[model samples]
Target: AAGVIQSPRHLIKEKRETATLKCYPIPRHDTVYWYQQGPGQDPQFLISFYEKMQSDKGSIPDRFSAQQFSDYHSELNMSSLELGDSALYFCASSVGGGGETQYFGPGTRLLVL
Candidate 1:
């Protein structure tokens, strides 16, 4: 019953700072995705990787980037943070191509002050 794992469950940052969030997907899963949820908003897809290659892109901002590793873990990098950037960031993993059931990790709550 292993699921996705995310680090630094919560983060506090000042304007213009940077933050990196990490995600470890379940074993054997090959597709990873990132999502961001702002206050009173639904989770929006940022990007996704399949088999270590960039597979899709969504609403991710220019100030952000992401990648997946050989072990299938992924990292989302955000920079020049702004107050509006505060939100819940989480990652999900699926078995193969997208459309499969994805398992999500506990979100990382980010706050900008």
Candidate 2:
């Protein structure tokens, strides 16, 4: 399997702006997950999608959202981003279920000014 892939590698945004990041998971994978890892902090779960439907969501604000395509690719959208949103956003994937080990991508580092 090819695992997961994310783009931009890095991003810089001013407060109240919007940012869109992308992710593509290995073929045949049924689940895609998103997470946020801020400086000096562990990765925080953002959301998960299975079969193109959201299966779970974490404590992220409304400014954060995601979508899954038929090909198992996904995108994370942040609206009116704030300084607090600056972090490394990681996209991961696994077969559907909660106990499996997720494979992650290199991540897109977002720097909100």
Winner by TM-score: 1
lDDT of 1 at 29: 93
User: Which ranges of candidate 1 are over 4 A from the true structure?
Assistant: none
Task: Please provide, for model 1 over 9-76, each residue's C-alpha lDDT reduced to its tens digit, 9 standing for 90 to 100.
Answer: 99999999999999999999999999999999999999999999999999999999999999999999
TM agreement with the true structure for every prediction = 0.97, 0.94
lDDT of 2 by residue, 50-99 (tens): 98999999977897889999898999999998899999999999887562
Candidate 2, residue 14: the lDDT equals 96
